[model samples]
Target: MSVVTLIGAGQMASALTFPLFENGHEVRLVGSPLDDAVIDRLREDNYHVNLRRTLHDGINYIKCADVKEAIKGADLIVCGISSFGVEWFADEILPILDESIPLISVTKGMLDYEDGTMQTYPEYWQEKLPEGSKLRLYAIGGPCTARDLSDHDPSFVAYCGPDFETLEWIRSLFSTDYYIISLTKDVVGLECAVALKNGYALGTALAIGIKEKLGDDGIDHNNMKSALFQESVKEMLELLRIVGGGVDNIMFAAGDLDVTVSAGRSRTVGLLLGKGYTIEETLEQLQGQTLEAVVIATRTARAVKALAKAGKVSIDDFPLLMHVDGLLNEHATLNIPWKKFERHM
Candidate 1:
């Protein structure tokens, strides 16, 4: 059993604590200044207000106020922050961090620089660490959701990093009978797929909603939706290739596109749109919830468009992604250009 320090106190963060505790690890959850109330409540009551769950009893679960104290002698550091918070978090903890500690991120999103350079969360964090540092960074991706994992449901995810040997060690540390871990060295491809999947899940939801609205009870539009699903994968692979990544990472679920698409938060927003709700109405409905797909859609679109302008990738290469971006950000109509889509490319 090793001591693990988890950063952030959101649903994903809270959900993770259970498995670690069950697997006989000493866990310390550290909250940012923004999470003062969350830490205070969790500290006093042994329950997290946001997660609406009590901490598992009979475990050495500790919550710390300061980052330095939380990670003082941690065997591993897991960042549960959202993509938007990673940069600030990196800056906050870098001054006190041990460069040799292994870092794993469950965050899935892309970073876009002002100059239009785009990198995945792990890549961005790796860059933010001191130059020539020994910090090994990894990211988890695939269909594992927080709620499912919180309930101890059987789940699997792709554990990706630079080396298989180190990743295997990480996998063993995090794995439980109910929580399965697979390995990959396709960090770029995995991160890109994870970052981009929420956007595509919204598309899948929209397709499902439109089919139901059209009175197809059989969900027989599986054919049409499957096309949309494959189109999403093609666009993902193209985006990966454009950004110097390989497409072989998608091999396991090669025939089952739905397996790769997680039931993400953005699907709710897309379902609303597919059910004929306006963009204003959708945003109004999702007022309190963090719509990560919305953020990724806008940011990734800007990054991809910048790449297109620089001739790194053509705008035509990602019609579905760009179309969904317009639908999300510009209040554009749901109508997409299906004719321009490449079915087998």
Candidate 2:
């Protein structure tokens, strides 16, 4: 069994750790110093994951006051922190990580302030690790949710890495009856697909809500919704293509369309926004964590513009780019003519 060290004791971390423990792998879990209450709870519970139906136990717990002590002898390090916290963790924790240890990043989303760069969790850490370190980086993405896995339901996720051996190793570590893990070699494309799917989901939710509000007193609402979804998918695929992603990434992102467009935390946030809720108001009402898609939409709008100017893609093929640009610029009342968009096609 591989010795695994997981950083961040959030929902994702909890879901991943339980499987590792059940597989007989020695697991060490580290939580942020600021999360004293959660640390206390984990200590009291003996690092058992109380999944409501099943209790998973025997994982070692460390209340990380220092980084070196947390990852001294770890073979594989899994990071489940939020995207915004990546840089901070890199600076504070990754420097102490073992040089030969392989790393897995489950976090998804683009860095909005960083020129709209879409980086997976491992990529962020690789940038911070020692220059000559032989650290291998891997990424995990797909439609799987923490709640589904915790409930012992089957869910699929795609894992990709530059190293085939490391990819296979991670796949072996996480695979279970409830969690299906697949390996891939398209690391860049995989990460980009994961980030762009969120923007498409938001767009899909908004279009659905708008269609419902338009009072379908005789309109082909179903066709409109279908067209909107297809167009959004195409737009995302095109955006990814312009940024050098592969067709397989597009296929994987589309295959996982069920969760993105269906009812979920991110889609619900989009629905609320469609109903005219301000960002802050929507966040408050949901009482849930915000997905990085909101910022992604804005950055994607900028990226589309750059691509169009560079002739990487035709503006005529994606009129949504123009609409998104206007939307991001706060000109919310503007609309693109269907004929103009169709002409480009």
Candidate 3:
């Protein structure tokens, strides 16, 4: 049992404290500046308002001001913040971080450029540090959701870092029967696969949303849903090849898509859009929630356009993602682009 500190008291980060507390680690849940309300709730009642559950007493809740003291001797530091908080984390947390303390992130996202280049969250964080820093970066990927993980459900996820021994040690800090972890060194592949799934999930839900919108209680759109799933995986495979990631992590890609479509936040956005909700209307409905899918959809679409311009890849290969981008940004409706799929084989 080591001193495990999780920064950012968001849903996923707060939920992850379950494993750390259950494993008998001296866990510190540090709330970022944005999580003042969450920290207050935890301190007052050991309850996470978002998860709507009471946590164990073994955990220590710290506020943003006391973050320096909370991470004083933490053996393992988990970057449990979302992608949007990376810049803040870098500015506030990285400067005081010890290079020796292992850093693993629960953040799932990619930094895409117009030149067809992409970097995982860990890599992006590494670039923020001064050159020659020994701060090792790791990321968690796959289908595990905050709700499932918080409920102690059996969730499979991949932990990608550089060293096997170090990754195993990090896994030892939190890994339990229900919180299963698979180790891999393909950091780029794992991150790309997982982050890409967020966008595709919206498309998957469009199938369901459209069917439900028609008031057709007679038939289900599982066939269309499955087709979207297959096409999403295919585009993911093409992306892996383009972004210099391993194509063998197909399970991570497909598994994440399945899980997100099943219960992830992106599913809700997709459903609303599929049901003929306007982009502004859908966003207004989900105002406070973190819209990872919306951000990724637009970014992925831009990346594809950039790549196509560079003659690196064809934009036609990613019809689902493109349609998602159009749906969210271009105010395009739920046109599934069924004709664009299965053109490769």
Candidate 4:
């Protein structure tokens, strides 16, 4: 059995300990500086504070102060923090990291540069490592959620890396009967696909909010939702093309979109926007919760705007995404822009 040291006790990270521990790995879950409360909860009882679920027993819980010692002799390292923890992980973990140990991130999002360029988390992390470091970077993307994985639901996802052979090795460690794993060498495509799902999922979910605003709990606006879903896949494919990723990567993109449109913080924010809440009001409603969809939507809109200026992509090509971004950042009201979608068709 391998010793798998995870660096964050986040929902997805903590849920992951179940499969790994069940698979006979020695899983050490180290809490980030932000996860002290959750770590204490896990220590008190296996109950996870944020996830609202009990985790598997026999997993070791290490505090933030002991992260160094917790990672000792780790056969594999899981970068389980969210995007907000990227810099912190670099500053606190990278310096002491063993370059030979491979790392896989469940973190989803891309970093936007001053020039409006975007790079996936793994790419950004790779650049921050010491020159000539042997650390291999990998990320998982798909529809796996914290609650579902915690219950050992049959969730399918892709473990994406630069090398196919190594990804198979990673698959061997985490794949279970309930948690099926697929491998992809298209890192950019896989990362972009999953990150794009967050924004598009929010966009697709606006119909629910719209239906609620229409004062009809009995009627489902699945028609509008399905249209948004299709347009999302189309735009996602174009985004991948511009970024030099395989268009076929839409498999993960569409599947993630399907799952995300109905659940998570993305849907929550989208519902708020559809109910006519201002971004400030919506954010207040989500106080203390992370909105990955809003973060990626606004950042991707800015990046794509730069691309549109460069004639790499048309700003008009992403109506749902741009509309969602406006609702989040521009003080714009909730308008579906069905006209823009028609033009796209």
Candidate 5:
């Protein structure tokens, strides 16, 4: 059995191990030094609290107790860290990793830099690696959630990267009867779709929150939500064009991922806002949790505005995007301009 080293002990990291073990792979999980308590709990209880599943017998817990030792002689690497932590973990493990081994990143989100450039995780990681490194980098995105994967519920995900051979091989290792895989060479489109959907899906969540607040009985506002979904897809298509990615590729990234976010925690942020929670109050409710939707929405809005100022993109092309950006970052109201969207219908 091939030994796979998973760097990060978060919910996704723990849940993803199930598929690896199912494929007859030995998993070595390396959590952050800060996650010692979680590691201890997993070891003692023989279960991952976040995943709510008993530990697979083939899995080995390596509590950042020895970073190098944890990763030694692994056949493959998978990073399931949060967007904020991916770079830190990359820095720690890059030196210990051989250039030949492939690193698949399940972390999704754009990295907003002080320089006013927003980059995908793969681009950020590639820039961080030492010069002349040939490390194969891959990314996973789309509708699959950790809970579903851990529970062996049917799931589908998109895999994209520059190395087709390695990507396909990694695909073979993870794809099960329950977990389906789709491949794409359009990394920019896929990564941007994955990251941008969280920001755009906030609008749909706002609609859900408003529906719940109105206490509407027997009146499914699927039309209203469909409108928000269309707006999100339109904005995502515009973004893909501006960033030199194909519009059709958005179906794989934005279309699939937006549906997932609508049904997941990413929607919770917008729901709180719709329920009349102030930004501060909402953040307080989400204390100690990293809401990538809120973070990405705020950062990407600024990044897009910056890109517009530089004349790289047309600001007027993204009204919904700008509106949501203002709502998330500038403390603007939850008002949406329905008049501006008549042409879309």
Candidate 6:
């Protein structure tokens, strides 16, 4: 059994920990003081997950104060931290990690400050690692939610990277009665798809919320909203293309099918925002924390506009690009006419 060290005790981390423990792997969970409180609650309550109504049946708790101590002898290191925490983690923890251990990131969303300059998660981590350190990095993406996994719902997740053997090993480790793990070499595509989907989800949510506000109005707002969502999905895919990601990434991001525009937690957050609730207000109302998509949609919209201005992409191909830009910039009055957007039908 591999000794796995999971850094971050968030919902996602907690959801996955049960599977690792059940599979007989030794799990060492390292967390901040706040995260430690979450762990304490889990242990005191006999390990309850909101996602799953079932209770865990094993010794799943192994808390560590420092990341170095948590991962010192670990065979694999899983990072489920939020995107915002990644840089701090790389600075404070990655340097202490042994080069031999493989690192798997379950986080999604790009570093806005990095722009498209940093293409993939592995590349970002590699830049932080010491030169000549042979560290294998892999990314897990697809539509598997923490809620589904916590409740032992049958789910599939893709593990992809340049290291084929390592990817296969990870696939094997995660494959269980309820969890199916697929391996791939399209690491960049996979990561890009994961990041871009957040923006699409948010944009779709906003469109839906707007449609609700325009009830019985002259515009066939529901139909227009649906088209807007579809167009946004296509636009996001195009943006990913400019960044060198594959069409397969879209399939993975959409959960191997055409996902409804109003799907996922991030989209729900967007809907709330569209209903005149500020970001902070939406967060307070959400049953759980919102993903980076709410902010990412805005950042990516700016970056895409910059790239478009630079002649790096075709503006005509991404009509909704400007609309997303308008939404993100809080530009209530857009230069583009509303009737022109409706004409796309």
Worst lDDT 10-window in candidate 5: 336-345
Question: What are the clashing pairs of model 4?
Answer: none
RMSD of each: 2.7, 3.4, 1.1, 1.4, 1.9, 3.6
lDDT of 1 by residue, 48-82 (tens): 78777787764333444467778888998888877
Per-residue CA lDDT of model 2 for 273-301, tens digit only, reads 56665566766886756566666666677
lDDT of 6 by residue, 1-345 (tens): 988888877667767776887888887666644466656666676454434333365534545466666776788988877777777778877887787889898877665443434256566888788879898888888777777787788877788877789888877667789988877888878887777777676666676666565566677666655665667667767766777777777777666223424366667765765665655566688746646775667667666666667777655665565555555556443222334444343
Ranking by lDDT: 4, 3, 5, 1, 2, 6
Q: Compared to the true structure, candidate 2 yields what TM-score? A: 0.85
Instruction: Name the candidate, 3 or 5, with the larger lDDT value.
Output: 3
Could you give candidate 3's per-residue lDDT for residues 105-133 as a string of tens digits? 99988888868787788888898998899
User: Which clashing pairs does model 3 show?
Assistant: none
Better of 2 and 3 by TM-score: 3
Ranking under TM-score, best-scoring first?
3, 4, 5, 1, 2, 6
lDDT assessment of candidate 4: 0.88
Superposed Cα deviation of residue 345, candidate 3 (Å) = 2.3
Clash totals, every prediction: 0, 0, 0, 0, 0, 0
Task: Quote the lDDT for 200 in model 5.
Answer: 82
Q: After superposition on all CA atoms, how large is the RMSD of candidate 6?
A: 3.6
Output the TM-score of candidate 5.
Answer: 0.94
In terms of TM-score, how similar is model 1 to the real structure?
0.89
Q: Estimate each model's TM-score.
A: 0.89, 0.85, 0.98, 0.97, 0.94, 0.85
Indicate the TM-score of model 3: 0.98
Better of 1 and 4 by lDDT: 4
lDDT scores in order: 0.76, 0.69, 0.88, 0.88, 0.79, 0.68
List, residue by residue over 33-149, the lDDT tens digit for candidate 5: 667777888878668776677878657888886767867788888887888787686677776787788888888898776545778888888888899999988898887778877
